[model samples]
Target: MDEMTWLDYLPVLGQGAWVTVQLTVWSTLFGALLAFAAGLGKLARNAAVRGLSVAYIEIFRGTSLLVQLFWLYFALPLVGQAIGINLRLPPVTAGILALSLNIGAYGAEVVRGAVQAVTRQQYEAARALNFTPRQTLFRIALPQAIPEMMPPFDNLAIQNLKDTALVSLISLADLAMRAEQLRNYTQDSTTIYTLVLLMYFGMALVLTAFMRGLSSMVGRWRPAQR
Candidate 1:
């Protein structure tokens, strides 16, 4: 294979790149949901729940994701044998779970901070209206939090997209893996990585546009876009 064949790898890049995007999108979506739940649990008055949520957020945030990936991909099997429930997941599954948990940790802080930024006056007014805590949270507080959360959430989504490249290390055949294979076959590291970089750049551009659109939509919902 030669530099001329770089063009031949474009379709492969597209197909492999999509795998990265899929991992990020699905994992981030699920992770954001989990993060919100964990964050809200942290805010709860129940000590045990708050403590557990705190522990989870700290442990995930404190550790290196690469290390966590190693543990999930390698270590769990040793411990799994004792329990007889296999923790050995495919590279894709392990990647998803690790990324999701990582995102959930950071996302938990984003959720907590955004929720806290909701004004005390709003909470008082909701109280005056006799709205229950749940109603106030769902209807009043979270509405206000949306605008604030949008920027960070968008950033997190993009960050996760980039981070998904690490999944290729586990042999998930993502963009990086495809790039590696191309380089190995062609022995042209320059063009191979160049195309891979371009592929990543394109994906980031698309994600940025989508995120901007989402921010606009959220702003409209908040009556602040005007």
Candidate 2:
């Protein structure tokens, strides 16, 4: 066979890139939902709700994401078997779960901080208007907080994108795994790795731009702080 050139590698790498994109998109979407839920939960009046949210945020944030991924992909099934349940997840599902949980934990703090930063007066105004706590949070607090959350959320989104490479460890054919496979077959480490680096950079750039636009849109809804 003719020696595979860089051009020849594009198709395979592109496939891997698509998988990486899917992982990032799904994980980030789910992570954002978890972040809002847990973040707000931690501030809830219900002790049990607050405790559960705290526990989730701490457990995922405190642990190594790589270990979490391994535990989900490798250990959970064995635990399930011992308990007479089938808990095995597909590699892609496992990867998304781990990434979402990990990023969500960190993003939870961002949500909590931003919400808390909403001036006390805002809450007072809500109370004056007879707004229920839920009304206060959704109508007054989150709208303001979301704009603040954007910058950190953008960082987390990019971090999540890069972190998708870890899924390759579970034999998900994401970009990094594809690069490794190509390197093994081609023995052209320099070219393959360089291309991989460039590809990741390109993806990050696009994600950053998207996040910025989202941030701007959300910021428009933020009422001017007194």
Candidate 3:
């Protein structure tokens, strides 16, 4: 058989790359929302509530994501059947669920740290001004903590995006899966994996660039002194 040119696999990579982007982007955005809630829960006044959040974070963070993907793809069907829900999660949906849960666990710690970074002085000032806890949080603390947390949050985003490749293990048509398929037919495993590596690098570089640009813009804005 003639060795096919790299052009033959571009379409496959393109399709796979799109799926990877969708998985990473939506999961990160919505997962961050979930994490914000979970993270706040980790700091809840109720000991039980905080404990639940902490346990959830530790469980997900401690496990391998590939295992989570397999469990979601395979084991959940049995549980779903027992509960009478649909006994299946499609690849993309499973990817979203697994990715969301994983990222949410990590993001919880980020949010907790960011929230705590707000100085006591700021909280005291807000209280003196008669701001409610929620108001002080939304109006005074969140904005201040955002910049401090941005670095960690940005790192997480890049990490999650790269991690999306793991979804391919569950038969997701992601970039890595496409690369593997190309390798199967062409037997040029070296080149295929190399391309996959570069593809992920390219996407991460784009994300890193965006974060750096946003940091510069926010830095230039420099909030006005009270």
Each prediction's TM-score versus the true structure: 0.95, 0.97, 0.92
Report the C-alpha lDDT of model 3 over 152-181, residue by residue, as the tens digit.
878988989988999889888899889988
Q: Order candidates by lDDT, high to low.
A: 2, 1, 3
Instruction: List ranges where model 3 is wrong by over 4 Å.
Output: 216-226
How many clashing pairs does model 1 include?
0
Q: lDDT tens string, model 2, 1-226?
A: 5699999999999999999999999999999999999999999899999999999999999999999999999999999999999999999999999999999999999999999999999999999999999899999999999999999999999999999999999999999999999999999999999999999999999999999899889897556644
Worst 10 residues of 1 by lDDT: 217-226
lDDT of each: 0.87, 0.96, 0.86
Tell me model 3's lDDT, rounded to 2 decimals.
0.86
Least well predicted 10-residue stretch by lDDT in candidate 3: 217-226
Best by lDDT: 2
TM-score rank order: 2, 1, 3
Name the candidate, 1 or 3, with the larger TM-score value: 1
Better of 2 and 3 by TM-score: 2
Candidate 3 collision pairs: none
Q: Which one wins on TM-score?
A: 2
